[model samples]
Target: MRNILTLAGKDFRSLATSPMFCLIAALCSVMWSFTFLRSLILFAENTQATFNPGPSPTLQMTVFLTHISQINLLFVFIVPALTMRLLAEEKKLRTYDLLLTAPITATEIALGKFLGAFGVILILVALSFLYPLATYPIAHFSFPPLLAAYLGVILVASTYVAVGVFASSLTQSVVLSVVMGLVFNLFLWFLSQGAESATGLYMTSVLEQISIGDHFMAFIRGSIRLKSIMFLLSCTGLFVFLTQRVVESSRWR
Candidate 1:
């Protein structure tokens, strides 16, 4: 456990110091801030206009969060970029062998790297809460829905990290890892698209259930379904397990 935390801390520090992390974090912050401000202004204006009869503050805030969560789409590219170097760089620098032969087991190494990457993502997610928190004093919206949306975002981010780590384990080239990770993320994100064109009800149901976006929508709508939670968690665990297998294979090579 100590070894895992140590490795996770090292990877977290590594990512925290990188220039790419700074750029991505800044871009996301700016975009989210702008969106929040615009939405809030519009909500206030509509509320004051007698003819408008605008939505409730709670609903308006929920919509604002829904818009903010769209930033997760941007993470499809950002996460792969962030995770590309986790394992690929280790292989490129030829340090993977040293680690493989060290006291750490493959599972520990995979989980540690995952935790490191996840820690960085958590920072970005935390920053997102600032806007809502700042507005809460004036808006006084419900906490449950807001919390649920954040939960959805975290689960989606976890899935992204797991996929990114698995993709990173596949190759020594960081570029290849990014491409593989993006492809995997896109496939998972769009999995439900198949349901749209399907003729059979059962086939459509299966595709929708398998989609990462469908489950995420449930949380954004303020409904915490057990199946959705399990599905997202299952995806996270599945890829982490795949990453462990990939790392273990290095012992033979």
Candidate 2:
């Protein structure tokens, strides 16, 4: 346990000092700020303009979910930047040989790197809360759904980080790692889109079940479904496991 945390801390420091991390973090801050403000303004306008006061706008759209979901799509670009160096750079600099020789297991190394990247992602996701906090007096957001939406974003982002880690493990070139991460993430994200054009119920159901977007909606709407949570956790674990296997193979070779 101590070893894992130590490795995670080391990677986190490495990531924090990198220029790419700064770029991605800055980008996330700018985009999320714009989206949060826009969503809040629109929600306020719609509330004042409407004759019927329906469900709480806070509940209706949930401030974070309103635009965060779209910003979440940017993970395809941002996660790769964050994770491309985890293992790839280690290999490129031949530091991976030293790392493999150290007193650590492959699983520990994989999880540590993942947790490190994920820590940064958590900071990015937390940026979504700024507008909500600034506009709290007027917004009067509901805490329950707001928190639920936050959880959903974290899960989705973690899944992206996991995929990026796996992609990083596949190659030594950071460029190739980024490309692979983007392609893999794009496919998983859009996998649900195929359900619409499917000719058979089985195909449609299968796609819907595996679709990240489909599961993601339930949380954005402020409903926590057990299945959705489990699916995301499973995806995250699967990729981490794959990364560990890759690292293990390299360890033996």
| Most TM-score-accurate candidate | 1
Segments in model 1 whose C-alpha atoms lie over 4 Å from true places: 50-62
Model 2, 95-166: lDDT tens digits are 998889999999999999999999888777776566556676765556787677778889999999999999
Q: Give me the overall lDDT of model 1.
A: 0.87
Evaluate all candidate structures by whole-model CA lDDT and list the values in order.
Answer: 0.87, 0.84
Cα RMSD to the true fold for all candidates: 1.8, 1.8
How many clashing pairs per prediction, in order?
0, 0
Best by lDDT: 1
- In model 2, state the lDDT of residue 94: 96
Please state the error at residue 120 of candidate 2 in Å: 1.1
* TM-score of each predicted structure versus truth: 0.94, 0.93
